[model samples]
Target: MVAFASLKCIIISSLLLPSEAFAPQSNLVNKKVSESSTSLAGVGKVVNRVKDSLLSKERSREDLKIGIAGFYDRSSQIWEEVWGEHMHHGYYVPEDRTDHVQAQIDLIDEVLKWAGVPEPTGDNKDELPKKCVDVGCGIGGSSRHIAKKYGCTANGITLSPYQAGRGNELAKEQGVDDLCSFQVADALEQPFEDNTFDLIWSLESGEHMPDKEKFVNELFRVATPGGRIIIVTWCHRDLEEGEEGLTKKEEKLLAKINRAYYLPRWCSVDDYVRILKENGAVDIKREDWSYIIAPFWKAVIKSSLNLKSLVGLLKSGFSTQRGAYAMFLMLRGFNKGLIKFGLITCTKPKE
Candidate 1:
């Protein structure tokens, strides 16, 4: 029955939805409603209920929460050191650098390009910003890039106040301060007027949202008529329910990821697209970049083992146990084929 439902849901979702399925609402109260609506809508309601009954009790484990916090705390320290910013995933290093570090940064640049962010110029606002919002703007690397490359004003928001502060500092240093600003804001309840941003860029942040539809809808609402939203996120494979619960391997993998990485939940690329379309986005385009992004987690695991980095991490007062937990989760997620790295772009219609 579970497998049949998973397959059925996949077919319905894939055939219809866009990517903004995880997007949120206008303010605080309605935010919850939007979230509930998106999750409970159509097939999602069934999936959510089943998942909750099976996993909700374990979802709030203290040890898991602590581990995730440590994971963020440790990684943020390393990011600040490397890029003079607080980005969690990777950085944009120019193509001309001579070192291994520079080469890796170049790879990040490629990902950004692949993700559709144009190369940064000294003057960005003129090119990129008809209106823009950078979701989860860790350390402001990409946000600054958006402002500099497009020469348009941008509002970069993050759940982590630390990330926002660091992003603002870097933006100021890079002289894109006037065009780019950072705010400590929830992606689920963005603090912007409707129809404000022309471009919304969410880099690997959608996984953290518990109520997926609200998050996507909020992005849609802020987008000016005919504006665009781009999402590059970590996701899980489409489920195929069988005799037991949710493929034991897959369930374990998702639980591990959620426990270690602070992600509220993970969903399939097809489901993501469905929610977006249902929420009113049109002409959605999606591409799975899992093959290219698969190695990023490998690199993260490697970085977690650096002795010098470990020393800093220790001094930073984070838990090595939690770091281990996160790495282990990443490994499990990859091995089980439960996580996917994907990209989506869509345009809101002009009213």
Candidate 2:
């Protein structure tokens, strides 16, 4: 077994430092360029050329989507065996800092609390959601949680057939089969009627979307008027007007992370805010939970050393093994402030 005690000590010690120490350097170049006007114009052309080159080199969206499904199909069992049902990060409480499982559960609760989702009670049928949809539901953990908590009927969609089957099995096991269901469906083209769901919940799925505009529109299409939409995902830092975009180093790092995780690309939280606003969503709010969720990678890294996880990682083949290695990259990215854990909530305008 991994030396969990020593690992915990190291992670806890590192996390105690001031948050500013983790902030990445800004890419804004404040100095004025003294080159000739012709030279400046040429430089702009060269920059555009480089940007186009990078865009052309990105993986095809269809291939990436297929790859992501395969990645999860192969690795789902490993995740379930090691990290429990919730496939996302955890929230650590200073007072109740006990084990990883409870911390993960607490993270789910924290996300709901941050999104201002009221706790459901048997008496609040009118107040609670009647229909919910979990876009990118991983093994139906969040779907089951919502269904049981609010007595709502939930539908979960994922690209992986294995995950869909497993999620249904889990729902049956938890005695929520009637309340929740899972199916293989694409988020970009969700198989649901417009205004179908009272709540649309997406957790850690936004990163996989290659066409973010289409993704957001799909969410809106499936949601009822005044329906609550909550999204939690990875985001990059926002770029200011007149400031340069990501540096070459940052781009290269992100490219590597994307390949390992089967993600298309990452957008800034501000980008998401703008899209939500343009889509006519109201009460738009955002929170950066990066600091709170920073400790998750450490816990996952330590857990990977367990014999069961090691065996599973090996059995799952190269992609899953690479993903395990990428955990270190995520840790570094968070520490450098290049990666952000973001939460955004909005409501469709009541017509």
Candidate 3:
């Protein structure tokens, strides 16, 4: 009980840092300009745009990258210790009680199943993709899984160098190093040639993208003609017809989530489909898996109650703890139907 109290304190305190850290500095000159400005209405509109798109304040690309890398650097190992190698949410079945870790692996299989990515049914496993990319791969769990299952080479990329290094170490330890490679790379500008990968997989990474269009374009650019692309991400509810945008209350809630997770902005699953279509993707598919993933955050909260998890969170630093606190907010958003667990899949048309 005492330990829990300390954890609560850390979470609350860390939560206060985001706005201060990201807000632009004030100065006399800026104040004078504000005083001299005639059109404050336009500035308010601009501020709202930035708030919804960036955060409470503007964040440079480098700042966002560094924050994301630093958060993972501190927390990735702890997450591995607690949540296993797959750092994304688990897919649970109705009254289907399974071990938490297995649910995570099931999530991988389920995603592939939903995407219609077939696995080898015969002895020849090479029927699957020969080369695949796992964008924002966490510790290369999905990468190694795909490589082993398909008898293919899998490349995993992440901004966190620690994730890359640890992923490689795990691949070596698991005897899949020859089939897997992990490197520190940005998803926005993937370091791959056009039409190179037979499969492009991005699970739960699209939220960190500042430019959703560019992010999808990059994914499409590296795909071989007729290759598969799967993206499972967190998105807000789609706006109703004739609605210009989300309500301020909804934006405020998401803005809190964005700050805690080092996320750039929130977009709906519909937005992802539109972006994919605009980027020349064909056979686009999308689903709202919110109900399937509904229990994820609650399950995470339950796991974090133990003494070991608390110790780990304390050691991992404030960023991780802040994210830990945000878990409740995540649950709130999901319950209120403001947040969604979105899945999108598309095929690169054959040229």
Candidate 4:
């Protein structure tokens, strides 16, 4: 295990810019609803009683941070080689579009459009954000794209030093080094002043947060009043009224995913809406984007089967290999409706 203290020090040092750390009191609470005593409930009870379960559990944030950082540190090169720069899922328009790179870029574009961020025109420089921050940025792909598209200064924060370094190299190579930068930082304890960024973005990073409430709060805390925030993440299905929670099979499958990906837990899309509301965000909208992103795993599975990808996976480490295999598990989960792709957009109210 990576030493927690050492990792914390490394993250703090890698922040690059000096700012006071915001420490919000955690208001995380777990609530369970009572099950109805009906025939359907009896059937659900029988299902739960028959099988062992491995539902989401609390994990040490320090350990989780270390594990995730190490995983990305090792696997980033392999991903860059096999999947290009974007580490998140793609958005399919026609449901059959197969150009992987363009699809990933379109995912970003779609997200921006959903958030009502306008396309950059040379005439209207004032319409774009002056500053932006990307939480859990992987190799700064989204960061570079935002800088190039909007002519905005973007700061991308990740847990992996390798990702941060490589992202900086890419920014320099793309001639956006001055406008875009990358750093190793913690999402729960970001190193930035309150209300610093005009836009805050998090793509598929929420599941890795050990403290989801704190993660959401930090995003809101760093955004300037009226700043836009967009998040895309993996979510599980929300329980219906009086329905029992995840089935044993679903729990076991999620456990495999958690182990493979270093994720702390998966929440429902409704959970995110509640978190955003609790954090005082307004103009909130949530979209179930499961179908659009479902094709991404299939593409990844196909890409992973190639000779170059296999060699890279082997050289990366055991964790990468495990995660690569887990792609099939994710595909199964998606097919079974056990996993969902959720997108949320909101804004901090102007003070």
Q: Best candidate per TM-score, number?
A: 3
Best by lDDT: 3
Q: Per TM-score, what order, best first? A: 3, 2, 4, 1
User: Residues 1-351, candidate 4, lDDT per residue (tens digit)?
Assistant: 110111211121112111221112112100111111122232233223322222335457787889888887876775677567887777888878889789889999999999888878788787788899999888889999988888889999989999899999999999999999999999999999999998898887887888889999999999999999998888899878887788888887887777666777678988899999998889999988888876765565454333232223223344544554455466678789988888899999999
Clash pairs of candidate 3?
none
lDDT of 3 by residue, 181-249 (tens): 999999999999999998998887888888999999999999999999999888899999999999999
Clashes of each: 31, 0, 0, 0
- Residue 223 deviation, candidate 3, in Å? 0.3
Off by over 4 Å in 3: 1-56, 123-127, 307-316
Question: What are the lDDT figures for the candidates, one per model?
Answer: 0.57, 0.72, 0.73, 0.72
Candidate 1, superposed: residue stretches over 4 Å from native: 1-75, 83-128, 240-245, 298-306, 310-320
Lowest-scoring 10 consecutive residues by lDDT in candidate 2? 1-10
lDDT for predicted candidate 3 compared with the true structure: 0.73
- Kindly report which residue pairs in candidate 2 clash with one another: none
Q: Please give, for residues 1-351, the per-residue lDDT of candidate 1 as tens digits.
A: 000011111222221223343234224323543444432243344333333433433455345334333444345644455434424333223322234344334544565465455565666634444667888676676777656656778888865566677778878888888898988777778999999998888877777667789889888989988787888777777656553335766776676546435556567777789988897788788876656544444343434432233223323322332333344445456566666667788878888
Instruction: Residues 57-109, candidate 2: write the lDDT tens digits.
Output: 56888888888788777667656765668777778666335577777677767
TM-score per candidate, in order? 0.69, 0.81, 0.82, 0.81
**Cand. 2 TM to true fold:** 0.81
Better of 2 and 3 by lDDT: 3
